[model samples]
Target: MIGGVTAVAANGPAVNVSSVNVTPTDPTVGETVTVEVTISNQEGSNSIVDVSSIMLRTTSEHYERVEDVGAIAPGGSLTIPITTSFDSAGEKNLLAHVSAASQSNGSRTSHLRAYYRPITIDVEAPEIDAGIAASTNNSGETTVTLTNYGNVELTDAEIRTAVDGTQRDQRSTFDITPNESESVTFDTTNYDSDAVTLTGAYTARGERHEVTRTVDLNRQVQGEIRLTSVEVTERGTAISVDGEAANIGGTDVDSVLVRIPDSETVSPASGAGEFFVGSVDASEFATFELSSSVSNGTDTLPIELTYLVDNERITTTQTIDLSTASPVSPESSQDRPAATAGGDGSAGSSGLPLIPLIVGLLVVVGGSGLLYRLWNRE
Candidate 1:
């Protein structure tokens, strides 16, 4: 008891902090860290409780600060938990400190700083994403977009696109930051497929990552026009013609022109021989008129048709034969060709007009025979 005049009683109401414990000791940036501090009062006097302030601080490079704690009783201890996080990477020093005073004595003593295990923080790595989209117009093009959707920047990124398993285009971009995007285009007119895929690869923090995406094809408005029917009227040396055109393709056509092209055998009789058919909707038909003159021996004529598809002009030519039509005299009562159209059943005539000539010959022969007989009898 002589030596026990005693070490703890000699100093009195002394306050000190126990070792600190940090949870999730291995933490990445933006993650939470929990700090637990234990404050102890070593005094034996029950009436003289120790009042103390406990705080947590870092030596230099780190983010760890807790609210000061107060009021600890003699022969008692208190433990407090606080949450914190670090914004940067690397090692950080954590320290806990406590300052104390007692009612039995007015002296305040500062306890030695207690060090905890160092914290090593790791940063987030770069992430990349890719997606594909396809669109077809008259020119037939498909565009693929590669995006960096992650929170970090990537370097030396390469992107490749394919349609129906066939490689179409490939490109590379450098230092693509988060939210940045790049595009690659392929000619889909001849691609002949509805599915498209995009693949991208990049290097980040000495690691390589790859991403892929697939999309269906989207086609824009398109139009297709075709000649449906043609009718030819033989008016003396000139011919009056009417034709029907149909929109057989995907979209509607705004304007269509139908005409008989000038040749050695045929020429525009009255107008330019070209007529506008107006708008033709999908699966709809429009009519056009043309007047042309033909030479005595000419039997073939070319018909030219023009229309628009996706703002592009398309021209088509068709040949029709008129020799099969029966010859019609202006003196006869006939107005149109007696034969049916040949090519595509649209409008050219076939076969000769022998009915009118045969009738006239019979009447002339009967009349002539009667006159000759009467004259002989007289």
Candidate 2:
């Protein structure tokens, strides 16, 4: 009897890829990440499967690949790890693929492909934020501060300073970490400008950023000379004035001179025209004397002061009330003494009367002569 032959179908290897995971699911640009893909063999498979290749890829590009993976038993799973770095930042989809072959009769057959579920990865962009501030002190020293406010560290930081529009020779360069600050100081004593500008630049995440800050400089006079303790004394036809010059400003003054300018009512007194009080320091004083001849009907003494401040000449005028100095009247209470009553009940000057004293002198001389003649006759 001829029996009908029944053909048996062969069972191929089957693999199910699931659970696509990425270490550091939230990643920044240019940061490395690891992708783990779990590959499982179906329980109904007839033979052990050998994984040929495992690849981690996106929809448009492949990031990592590994070949020659070992065999996985039926109803068992194997995990494949791949490492890569993302060059850009944004939402990304990652898919993993596994190639497997069935091992039967000690031989491997054609590969079967399995794809893992795509995973969503959020890639963050690099953050860079910074600022700059500047300030100056009374001594003409300026300080600049650079602050990093973002997550990235700053590198190759440089600071440049300028007074008005003129750039300075001194430059500062350093590094600053995230959420930190750095400072630089410069001597701007020689620069007397009104404004100081600070420019700063730094590198973060392969990009350079620049910042600028401007500060107003307090332009104060280096030396301020003020007249103090002034006194006016009258000596015959000459008037002598003594005073102190106080320097109340920031620096010292040079070639300080006090003089009474020649005017209709006042003129310099001979050799004592100008008094020199040189080099008065800040918050210090120097004594000076000025002499002048004052005419009648003068009410104020116009005193002129000249000095050198920061190599520049400065002149100032001050006035002292002559009415308060000495009386202008001839019979002033301070100039003449009080009168007294004489023996004849008449008001006389301080001493005896001039004519009466002269007559008494003559009478005494005649008496002395008469006495001498009588002695000679005897």
Candidate 3:
């Protein structure tokens, strides 16, 4: 055939990868790492097969493959972009191969030396803040807020409460992104303790992060003096007393002291105990309870109560006025005054207590976060 007039050629040509450039070089784990492969024909003029549909193998187990990229032309150029991310940090080797059946398959071959950098991500401990109660509700709650202060995303967080180290309520496994915070509640209605320690943690990306907190579930019934039944036979009358005390934080309090009010000066009716309930956790309501113990005569009496919560002493003065205990008074009577506290509700409240999830630990094995030197690329 060639002797007649012209000579024929066999294969087209081969391909060579030039420079591999990643726009935003250093990116955090779970973030998109765009891979741009610059390739061109090295030998003769042949149609290049878009072979972006490639695969990658890494030293760590925190990566995935996206899709096949298009082909590159001979002597010409083509940039195929691939988006990827990692769970752990380490080294990874990537490759791009063209199929033999494609136009530039048998003739072209390309390879890349990719170094997946090392990323340090730690799941920080859960942060907790507690205070005393503010309202008069016999039963109340405390609120505990859990914040994620890590550089990575967290999932499946769990929170639990304990009274004197006894598990009361628990919430399990929730999701949260970095810098975000969550709140959990615990009711101390039926619970009574001097102090309580709250311990919590969570699981994320197959690792566990743990954290604990200490709080004053301080409930010290020091004296025999207490407010008994005092009802409203009349219209303008109300009454209430302390409900329960629980540990809302992570630490335990041994003993709490309340001030002894002067009963002679402020009327025998005015003055009880002292207490402080900080950062209400579960049942954080303060509505007083009204009981009947009237002589059918309209009268008024004052009382004082005190307590220490979260290292703070609080004293409250309350008055129970029996104005209309007659027929009309019995028909129209007011309920108890409300109790106020820091948290929405965690413990020591009137309503039913609630639970929440707390996540904050990790596993440091062979190459998890310890080997920052061997895997990172400059």
Q: Candidate 2 lDDT (Cα, whole model)?
A: 0.78
- Model 2 pairs whose backbones collide: none
**Best-performing candidate as measured by TM-score:** 1
Candidate 2 residue-wise lDDT at 267? 86
**Ten-residue stretch with the least lDDT total in model 3:** 1-10
State TM-scores per candidate. 0.49, 0.41, 0.32
Worst 10 residues of 2 by lDDT: 1-10
lDDT per residue (tens digit) for residues 259-278 in model 1? 88888778976565888887
Off by over 4 Å in 1: 1-129, 192-194, 233-238, 249-255, 281-283, 296-299, 307-313, 321-378
Tens digits of per-residue lDDT, candidate 2, 1-378, equal: 011221112344567674666877566688677877777877978888888888777778888899997888989999888888888988777666677778878778755645455666788786788888877776577778899887667899988888777778456567887679989888877876767878888988788898888877664547889899988877555677888999988878999988889988788988898988989998899998888998877778888889988788999998988755753444557777556566676666566666778799999999999999999999
Model 1 has an lDDT value of 0.64
Tell me the deviation in Å of residue 306 in model 1: 3.4
Span of ten consecutive residues with least summed lDDT in model 1: 1-10
Give candidate 2 regions above 4 Å deviation.
1-131, 137-221, 327-378
User: RMSD in angstroms, all models?
Assistant: 15.2, 16.6, 36.2
